[model samples]
Target: MTQYDVTLEWPDDGTDTVAVSPTETVLEVALREGIRLPYDCREGTCITCVGRVLAAGGDETPGAEEAVDAADAFDYRRQPKALTEDERANGYVLLCIAVPRADCRVAVGPMVRSEVGDSPWS
Candidate 1:
């Protein structure tokens, strides 16, 4: 059983960490653990589940990047710049598609403040 420790953080906030399987998507672990991560599609089409990984301490490999739709609330095309190269390089990962790459520590939530601003779901 491959287990990955996941650490999620919010803006100007602390961290929420949980242990999940390498085969599991971060969103699955989060939802199961009662962590309120806003996401529409369970697939990888929407960007509502975009976040960033801070570190990985386990022994799993990262997953692939998926195409994001422009209609979603957090669409890349809708943003100022659809996921700049630097942002991707900085470890910005989409939770819906990103599987754990070891026991990783990350800031999982809407990367954009405005997307989560009006919602009290966080």
Candidate 2:
């Protein structure tokens, strides 16, 4: 399996890097590594686990577009209904369903929750 190092960057908290596979959700890896990220539904229907990609570098995978920019760094396991079209196009991803296609920096915590709407954190 291809492994990616996904860094979670909080507004004021700091950052945590977790090793992830193409098939593994970023949330799964984050929790396993003890880097507690915000999450509620394990599915893609909630915004609690949303994060914004800040930067990324990746190679293209099968059935995926190249990670030319932060917005293109991940693939959702299912349709990510929690985000608006603008959010998705601009790099917002629900970490619970997001599989990294490359090494990336993601902003989580209150910073992200506030922007996504209806988040428990906000």
Candidate 3:
């Protein structure tokens, strides 16, 4: 299995780099690495895990030109419902379902407790 490098900017203003398999979601890798990323409804229904792709590639090259647009970079196997068309167009992605095709830098948002119910572990 091929793995891609993933750089995640957490809600608390910390950054972490980890390896993510193509078949796994970004949130999964973060959690496994002990990186606390905001997430709710691991199935992609909730918007709590929304993040923006700052950059994406096999190597770390800084600049907008080197970055992959989150709108186009996200795997289409599962379309997240929390984000609107405009939000997606603006680069918002649900980390719970996003599978990166290349190394990626993502800016995670604050955790929003689910209105439906509180997570027992949270």
Candidate 4:
């Protein structure tokens, strides 16, 4: 199986590194590794698991092509209801359903926390 490197950066807890298989969601991998990321409905109906894609590949230049490529790189299996098309274009992803197609750097939003005890999911 192929694996992709995922780096999650949280405001309070700094950063965490994990490897995810193409078949696994970011949240699933994080939880399995004991990394606490905030989430409400694991079903993608909520925005609690939202994170920003700080970087994906070398396509940081903002343009239609970059946006399309970013969308193609991150697999949000279901329609991410919590995010607008503009938000999606801007690199926001719902971690509960996001499966990276390549190595990705995610900026954990303010709503997220890292420590196991600090997690609302716990």
Q: Give the alpha-carbon lDDT of every model.
A: 0.56, 0.79, 0.70, 0.74
Clashes of 2: 0
Candidate 3 matches the true fold with a TM-score of: 0.75
- Candidate 3, residues 1-122, lDDT tens digits: the string is 88877787765778898888889888888898888888768876767777777765643455555434675556744867666666666666778898878777777755422212322233
Ranking by TM-score: 2, 4, 3, 1
Worst 10 residues of 1 by lDDT: 68-77
lDDT of 2 by residue, 36-109 (tens): 88888888787889887877784423234432333578987887777777778767889999998888778799
TM per candidate: 0.63, 0.83, 0.75, 0.78
Off by over 4 Å in 1: 58-87, 111-122
Tens-digit lDDT track of model 1 for 22-121: 5677778788989888877555445577676555554223352532221221123222222444555555655765666466656555445233223222
RMSD versus native structure for model 1: 9.5
